[model samples]
Structures are given as C-alpha cells and as structure tokens.
Target: MALSTQYADEDSQNVLIAKLDNAKNVSNILKAIHFKESATVFASSMGLKVTVEDSKCVQANAFIQEGIFHEYAVQEDQVTFKINLTVLLECLTIFGSTSAPGVTTNLKMCYGGYGCPLQLVLEEDGVLTECSIKTLEPDEILDFNFCSENVINKIIMKSECLKEAFSELDMSSDILQFLMSPDPPYFRLSTFGDAGSTHSDFPKDSDMIESFSCTQTQTNRYKVSLLKPSVKALGLSTRVSIRTDNRGFLSIQYMIKNEDGQICFVEYYCAPDEDVSDPYS
Candidate 1:
C-alpha cells in the first residue's frame, strides 16, 4: 500500500513514524548488534535506540539519529516496545540484501500507540512490500551507571587497529585481559588459552590512536564470550572509543558512517569478570 494513502488519516494515532530513502542504511546498522534474537526499541523525537542484552553482563545499543531519516515524527515523548530483531531485519531486506545500481529500497515504518503491530512498507522499482511484525511488552533495560567522572582510562583509536587484534583473538581463551598504563606497554590485549598466552600492545603515541588518557595503571579481565559480539560493531565502524571505569566496567563506543555519509553510533557496555583475581595486584 502507498504510504500516503495508508497513513493519511491515522497520523494522530501513530506514536512513531519514520521514512528513509534507503532501508539498507538502517538494516546495515542493526545488523552490527544482531547478537541477540530480541531487542527493545525506544523511539522519540531525537531518534531510535535499539538495545540488546545478554547474561545480564553485557549490553549493546544501536543509535539511529533522527537526522538520518528523511521524515521522522513521534507523537509522544517516548515510545518503547520489544521486538524480534531477526524478523525486523528480514522485513527490511525483503527486496534484497544487496543494493542495485541506481536503485534504492524506500522504507516507511509506523507504530500506532501501544498494542499495535509495527508496520513496515518497502518500495523499490514500483514494487511495494508490506509487513506488520508483532511487538512485545517492553523489557527493563540495564543501566551500567558508567559515567565519565568514574572513568580511569580512555582511548580513542581507528577501528582498523582493534579489528585486527579482535579477529586474531584466540577462541580457546576464556577471558580477554586488558592492561592500560602510563608507562611502557601503554595498551595491551592478552589472551591466555590452552596453548599459551598472547599479548598485543599498542604504544601510547601510535598514529592510529587519536586520544589517550590514563589516570593510573589498570588491568581488567572480561569474558571472551561476552565481548566477542562487539567485534561485529567494530568491524563496521571507522573509529572506536574504549573506556573503563574505576569499578573495572568496560565501555566501547563505535562511530559508524552510513551509506549517505550520516554518522550513527553503536556502543557496548560490559561488566568485568569478578571471578578472576587482579593479576597486577
């Protein structure tokens, strides 16, 4: 159905409505954080935030700013709902996963208050496909309570640097260790597996590093399984910011540039593995 004819009279009833010139932009960003099957979506005038969490220890958020959308409207201050990310992705790429030369898949998404199915309308080359995916009650999202004031170490670098390190990480390792200090071996990634231990270090003055601020030496360990999913976001981003709080909590924020040259952000928050003793101590 045509977007205008379908939503002409229901404008007042819609809690959220967004139109995009190319649906692939949204699909591509969402795919980075598709580690979980379900995600909670929060929509407002600013934009849409989709969050996926696992094991109560790790959380991932994908932010699609309102500026990315051609038309964005929200009747309420905030509208929240739980959705199946797998199903939503399938609907967004119904026409095809790849882009055709000079062809774009247009998308019109709508939500009619609570208890309404999320509506999706996609049109490409005069072909229109409609989908209505059921939405579940919103889930209580986790708050890591990570703040800048508590950050002990922070580093901003090109994603290419970390991408190589993550790609070569040892799957046999149960935990990934991070060491940040002001002295030599400023930043290091270590993995201890059955074979042995592996360490990759980046000098504080490396060209790839855009910013480096370390108040004190800190070494923290995180589960390899929990942090693995973030590699997907890292792979798609141009730059990334890695931060850790005094409590040893880890936060990674990826800066992603979409097809239209618009910037989006995907962030991951992870709690440190408490079972491991502090090796530095």
Candidate 2:
C-alpha cells in the first residue's frame, strides 16, 4: 500500500503518527538502550521517550524529540505502551542495518489508540515493506526522584576519553567506583578485581572536560553489570554528562548527534551499591 493511502484511511483513528526520512536515525538510538527485550514507550507532543529497565535498579531513556520527525502528530496528550525492542529495531532496519551512500529508508509509524498494534511502513528506493508489531500494557515505571537541586557532583566531558576507559573496564570487578571531589583526584573511576585495584583519573583542568562542578568529596559505587549496557550510548555520543545526587544516585546523560547533525539525548539512571562504605566518608 502507498504510504499516503495507508495514513489517509487511518489518520482519524491513529492516536500517533510520525514520519522520518532516515529510519536509521531512530534505529541507532534505540539500539543503544536494547539491554532489555521489552521497553515502555511514552509519546507526547514533545516526542517519543522509550524506557528500558534492568532489575529495577537501572533505567535507560532515549529521547527522540518531535523536531527529529519530518511529520509528527499526536492526537492525545500522552500515549503509553510497551513494545519489543528487538522487533522494532529489526523492522526499522529491514532495508539494511548499515547505511548506503545514496540509499535512504523512509519510515512512517502509526499507533491506533489502545489495544492496537503499531504499524510501520518502510520505503527504500522503490521497495516498500510493512510490519505490524504487537503492543503490551505498560507496567508501572520506577521513579528515582533524582533532581538537579540534589546533585552534589557533576562533570561534563568528551565521550572519547571515557569510551576508552569504559572499553577497558575490568569485567572481573563487581562494582565500579566513582570518586568526585573538590580536592585531589578531582574525578576518578576505580575497580577492584582479581588483578588488583585500578584507577583512571581525569584532571579538572584537562582539555577533554567541558565542565566540572564538585561541591564536596563524594565517593559512590555502582554495579558494573548494570552500567555495562551504557557503553553502546557512550560509543556514539560526542559528549557525556555525569552526575551524582546527595543520595548517591548516578545519572549519565549522553548527547548524541544523529546522521542529519541533529542533537538527541540518551540517559541512564542507577542506584548506588548500598553494600559499600559510606559515600561521604
């Protein structure tokens, strides 16, 4: 079916309709948060927010703003649903996962109210493919109550520097420690494994650091397994913002620029490993 004809008939019934000239843009962002099979999606006038969680301790959010879409319409104030991330990524990359120099895949996505499957239309060159994927009822999402006002330490740095450190992280370590202080060792990442304790420090005056703000000395630990998935996002981002709240909650925000040079954001929230020593000590 023609893309226009398909939407023309369902326009009135569809609660959400979005069109993107390059489907790879969305696919690439979604792939960064594909740690979980199922993801809850919340759509609003602002655009789409897809949330993927692991063990209720870590949550990843991918924000694709309305401006990214060539055409975007949301009849309701907000629409929420759960979908299979694996299936959605596959459908978005049906033409091919890799980008071809002259070829582009256009995507049209529609959701018809509640209890309706998400309809996807992909067109590349003269070929067209359609897919309907089942949607599930959304579960209660966790609220970390993390706010900027409660942030004790925050650092914005180039992702390339952190990417190398993350890629070399010792998997044998159960917990990854973060020490941010106004004193010496301004920013540090530590891991204690079978080999021994290893630390990577970034000087506050380093060229890679875009911004650095540390209220006091704060040391917190987070599970390596939970944070490992975020490497995908870090690998694609140009800059990353790392923050830790008074409660020791960890927030990592990645500023990703898509193929069209548009900025998008992916965020990860994680609770501190409480079994460790006092963070303020």
For lDDT, the strongest prediction is 2
Model 1 spans > 4 angstroms off: 1-6, 278-281
Candidate 1 residues 1-281, lDDT tens each? 88577578776678899999999899999999999999999998899999999999999999999999999999899999999999999999898856569799999999997899999989999988989999999888889999999999999999999988876778568899999998889999999877778888989999999999988899999999999899889989999999999999999999999989999999999999999864423
How far off is residue 66 in model 1, in Å? 0.5
* lDDT value for model 2: 0.93
Clashing pairs in 1: none
Error of 2 at 153 (Å): 0.8
Off by over 4 Å in 2: 1-6, 277-281
lDDT of each: 0.92, 0.93
TM-score of 1: 0.96
lDDT of 2 by residue, 86-191 (tens): 9999899888756568688999999998999999999998788999999999999999999989999999999999997875767578889999998888999988
TM-scores of the models, in the given order? 0.96, 0.96
